[model samples]
Target: MLKIVKTEILKLKRYHILWAGIALMLLSVMLTLFTSMANDGSVWDFTYMIEQVIKNNMSTIFPMCITLITGYIITREQKDNTLKNILTIPISFKQLLVGKLLVCGILSLFLGMICTIFTIMGSFLAGFPGFSVGLALQAFIQITFVNLFLYIAVMPIVILTSRFSSGFLIGVIVAFVYGYCGMFAAGDMKLANLVSVKK
Candidate 1:
């Protein structure tokens, strides 16, 4: 199990997925900073600003990025035909799948923490009140837990897609479509409420 997990981590070392995750974190930070500045530090109450930022940005970005990474993690192995080799190495399929999930999930959580830290610092530097280290940690924990659950829920779908075709593109498309549908449905509901309000 340990060896399989380590191997999975090593495989991800040179992948563009890590860099993409970092870029997403940076982008989230920049957006949060801009919003804080624009609000003149008054939009969200200080105590809740960090929580709001985490809820808004991480909930959306983290899941999408993790789903992409998870797809690539499995699909890349299939692409190179290395999955068969790995499977022959005495590792159970469950171990291999769970190991990969752990490594990818941890990486995703690390990225989330980076974004959380940036938000906390940016909020403070912007002179937003109610910045608490404890609260920031709480928000981080909340977001990470939610992301972990989402990753688990989506893992089987990703694995199934990869097993079918060994096609990273297809896996990515499927994951994105799944996520997009959920988000779109939520947005449609919100819009319906607005339309009803104006009626």
Candidate 2:
């Protein structure tokens, strides 16, 4: 299983999928930066900016981004017809899929960190005050852990969608809408807690 996971991670090397994830991760920061043009009368602080990044992530970008990347990586085996060779090594499709899922969990946290860095960049570039080491760590935890949990929420979609031929593109659309719905589920702490995987 460890070898399988390692192999799965190695396949991501030189792959453009992670590059896309990085760009998408930066996207939330860009969106928040754009919103600053409106002057909504809300003070922009480090925490506030990080909150915006998380809000945008839950609503628009991260879930779909991860899904698309995971989907592509999984589909590559089928598209390239490497399943037979993989099976020759006696690895079942279930084991392979599980390995990909684990790797994606790691990837989600990685993208979360990328998002946090850009959140700081967005805050400073926008001239938001109240930056501090503690705030940075909080933002990192909030964004990274939330993302990892959100990945759990979307994993079934990613897995199911990846199984079909050319379904990943479709998965992106579905995952986006699915993730966006989480915003609506934001009424109560108990309900919002459902949004967290730690529950």
Model 2 over residues 45-108: C-alpha lDDT tens digits? Answer: 8888888888889888988998899898888899889888888887789999999999999999
Please list the residue runs of candidate 1 whose C-alpha ends up more than 4 Å from where it truly belongs after superposition.
Answer: 34-42, 92-94, 164-199
Give a tens-digit lDDT track for model 1, residues 13-76: 7687788877776676666666655645466654556655554453345556676777777667
Off-target runs (Cα >4 Å) in candidate 2 are 188-199
Specify the highest-lDDT model's number. 2
Measured by TM-score, how close is model 1 to the native structure? Answer: 0.73
Pairs that clash in candidate 2: none
Q: After superposition, how far is residue 171 of candidate 1 from its true place, in Å?
A: 4.4
Q: Estimate each model's TM-score.
A: 0.73, 0.92
Model 1 residue 177 CA deviation (Å) reads: 5.1
